[model samples]
Structures are given as C-alpha cells and as structure tokens.
Target: MIVEHRIYTTHPGQVHEYLALYEAEGLAIQKRILGRMVGYYRSEIGGLNQVIHLWAYADLAERDQRRAALLADEGFRHYVRKITPLLAGQESRILVPAPFFTPTWQD
Candidate 1:
C-alpha cells in the first residue's frame, strides 16, 4: 500500500473555519473520488494552526488515478477554489510501510 500525508498550514484564526469547511464540503467530495480516508488531524503542538490528513492507496498508479479524478471533479474543484486562500502553505509526502506492518490491526 501507499500512504499520502498532507499537511496544511492555515491562516491565523482560521482553523475552525477550515475544519468546518472540510467536514461540510471538502471531505464529502474527497470521499466521492478517493473512496476511503485513513485519518484526519489538527495539531495541538508544532507551532499550531496545522491540519494533517492521511490516505491510503493500493499503489502508486492507483493513487495517481484517484487523485487526478478528484481534481477533475467539479465539486472538489469548487472547494479547492474556496479554500485555497485560507491556506498558508501545504506539504505532501508519500510513504511505504515496513514489511511487518499491519495497518488494520495492532498488538
């Protein structure tokens, strides 16, 4: 599996608005294209005003196809236009799990 970690720095005092918009609009549109969400987060440390989310894909090719489909979706495009101005900076990383890792179960 491939993992995507997206980190966003929101405008000062805009965390609440950003989360609300994401829940009400962004997430729904994302679900339509991406299908499953691994996790979403708001940082309580590391200088604040940060939002992070993780997504899992079957492979790099699958990730590319799904992400491109998402960007082409009209609803998602509209949300991007609305939310882009609220962002300070964004970063994304792709990760691979260790050989022994099991994402669905832990011990």
Candidate 2:
C-alpha cells in the first residue's frame, strides 16, 4: 500500500476556517472518492497553521484514478475554490512502507 501525506499550510489565523469548511463541506466528497483516510491532524508546534491529512491507497494506479475522479467532481471543485484562498502553501509526499513494516486498515 502507499500512503499520501498531504500538508496544507493556511494563512495565519485561517486554520479554523479551513478545518471547519472541510468538515462541513469537503470531507464527504473527498472521503467518498479518495477511499481510505488514515488520519487528519492540525499542527500545534512546528507549524502553527497547518493541517496534515493521511490517505492510503492500494497502489499508484489506484491513487491516480481516485484522484482523477475527485478532480472531476463539481462539489469538490467548489470546495477547492473556497479553500484555495485560505491556503498559503501545500505539499504532498508518497510513503512506501519499509521492508519489515506494513500498514493495514481493518475497515
């Protein structure tokens, strides 16, 4: 499996607004299309106005297809429009588990 670590840094003081918007309008559409969401978090120390979201996919192909489907969704596009202004920076990392370690989701 592959894990995607998506980090979004919000313009100062906009983190709550961003998180609230995601919870109220973006979560469902994204979760439905993207599949497994390992976790969602807000940074309190190193980076103050940042949100980190973790997602798991079976492989690169699955990730690409799902992301493409998500991009095509009008609702998600609208949400993106809403959130874009609040973001200052963004980063994405694909994680491959080590040889001796693997992660799985029971559900």
lDDT of 1 by residue, 5-104 (tens): 9999999989899999999899988877886688899999876899998888888998899999998898888999989999998999998999998789
For model 2, what is the error of residue 39's alpha carbon versus the real structure, in angstroms, after optimal superposition?
0.6
Off by over 4 Å in 1: 105-107
RMSD of 1: 2.4
**Global Cα lDDT for candidate 1:** 0.88
Model 2, residue 63: distance off in Å is 0.5
TM-scores, one per candidate: 0.93, 0.96
Which ten contiguous residues of candidate 2 have the minimum total lDDT? Answer: 98-107
* Candidate 2 error regions (>4 Å): none
Clashing pairs in 2: none
lDDT of 2 by residue, 1-107 (tens): 88999999999999999999999999999899999999999999997899999999989999999999999999999999999999999999999888887665824
